[model samples]
Target: MSSAGRALAVPAASDIVDAELVNGDETAASGVDVRTARDRHLSAETVAAIEASAAASTRRAYAADREAYLAWCRQEDRTVVPASAETMAEWVRHLTVTPRPRTDRPAGPLTIERAMSAVTTWHLEQGHAKPNMRGARAVLNAYKDRLAEQKDEAARARQATAALPAQIRAMLAGTNRTTLAGRRNAALVLLGFATAARVSELVSLDLADVTGAEHGYDVTLYRKKVRKHTTNAILYGTDPATCPVRALRTYLTALAEAGRHDGPLFVRVDRWDRLAPSLTRHGRTIGDPAGRITAEAAAEVIGRLADAAGLTGDWSGHSLRRGFATAARAAGHDPLEIARTGGWADGSRVLARYMEDVDRVKNSPLVGIGL
Candidate 1:
């Protein structure tokens, strides 16, 4: 996870932190001392709570960003902490102008901005003033314009290639249905596309979230947006080969027979074709059943399936979401209905953007005309 084209140069805690974050410089730099900062000693539970404030992903990025900043400051012979607005501006300018030392590729606008955000986060966390970002943002906007003028791929708005119904079937064909991983992946793909779920929602789906419904299964997304416990139906498709309903049952039935009827619907599968059991943070095994698959792993599953199926185009986790909207629109499903099924807000610009790509050709005024 390099935000920039080049790696962030983030080291492990063993590489960065010493015994304490704020030690006996007599709390000289910041008023707060590490040991006496709070009324109670900072318990592991309290530390976990504080870190949980940001998403796991965000916190990771912040860590990398902080390291990147430190590395950059060391290279440039500048002050590290309590970075000034001028330093930020200088960094962005350097990122914009210089080719990556190793790869010789310039960092994209988005990457530069993210790196800046990571640095700003570090400053604020240490009780320092947030670096004014106006200069850095201006640099970024200029960089974006330069990339657009040069027709760089990074300049274009990112969109995943839609995995339409036929393509979805092709991807399913790539999986070895006999294995636990294969069946689980098939269920993951079908449920993803059928419900237009983001990978995050798909992984959060516990067994309890899925209930039997008329003609299909109704699933409630654990992480809701706009609405709480938002439920959607997975209807039976005409083809048993590609039907989401059958895929889910087939997959779950295997799990049930294995005596796994609880916890995460999706879990890690080892190379041995064994379902991975949930584990504690200490690397200790928790019990039977399994842990939720990571969003990254889910994306890899989609990508691997797409490649195996020989379906051409950029396919990732988001392809399921983008594909669902486009496929439903192609079928003449009402826009509001499509939004409802996907848990998108009615009239969402993001959803509209997904459909609009295909619609440019599909919905052209000249499309059905004699042309």
Candidate 2:
């Protein structure tokens, strides 16, 4: 039997139910056998899974772009299924000049590229022939070349600022441990510095992912930049003042006092020490209903704390993680050790780049001079 025929030979019951929910009576009304209808639905699902295999954030952006492109096509009276090269090129022009609804700024080169990728993916999913070498892609490449010659990409790009350990310590000191929010932020800053964890990994943490050790805690991160190196070792601070483990314990105690045991390790709260109401119940306070703190919110919290501490310069969610690697390198730890601790893959040049500024001082020949 052919591949398609073999796949259709078996239909799971859940697939049928899902198909029914989606298609209503349309499939049934067509006089097709139930098995055939279910097989077709399952095939569609397989195609969807294939498309969705990309990162969650990428998939979400693609889905949104797909909708936006379709809307634009409808408004322009253009065909979207097999969007001609001309249509694609025209859409690229629109993306370049159009200000995003939220940001009110024209789409950056990266954003435009992602939008184009989404459009092309949609066309591919529809089984349209991809004349990528000759059509919209060619136009995009030429336009990109012109853009490159016109703009200094490096000058326009945002540089990643590495956080210093002292700055993080100052931020932690600025947090008010007396409040639930402060306690959470304290732990968050400490963990970010200690583990050098990406913002997404930090926000995805749950109460169950951490374990108490004699001196510190072991946090098992399920996702990170390196898939296999998810387990990170977090050490307790020598001082009670800035200890991440103690800060985390205090935060958990606050949660327990409020009758929350398991869920997001960090949650949103207002100034009154009241937790953000769970979205599931909508205004009703119910069991462990605190929602996950978003990455943007987490970064905003760090920025506010930094501002309060009177720390100057541009800080970001990546600051603490960068600080960790910077501090570790300055303390005489080797690159391999730093990479392992920061969840960086073996032989990662990115680690070296992060420690560049710090190394300038430590590895300088002036260090041994009699000045």
Scored by CA lDDT, what does every candidate get? Answer: 0.80, 0.74
The CA-based lDDT of model 2 is what? 0.74
TM-score for each of the candidates = 0.74, 0.68
- Kindly provide the TM-score of model 1 when superposed on the true structure, using C-alpha atoms: 0.74
In terms of lDDT, the poorest run of 10 residues in model 1 is 1-10
Please state the error at residue 173 of candidate 2 in Å: 3.2
lDDT of 1 by residue, 298-335 (tens): 99999999998887888889999999899898888888
Instruction: Write one digit per residue (lDDT tens) for candidate 2, span 42-76.
Output: 45556555544456788688889888999999999
In model 1, state the lDDT of residue 143: 87
Residue 315 of model 2 has an lDDT of 81
Error (Å) of candidate 2 at residue 211 is: 1.5
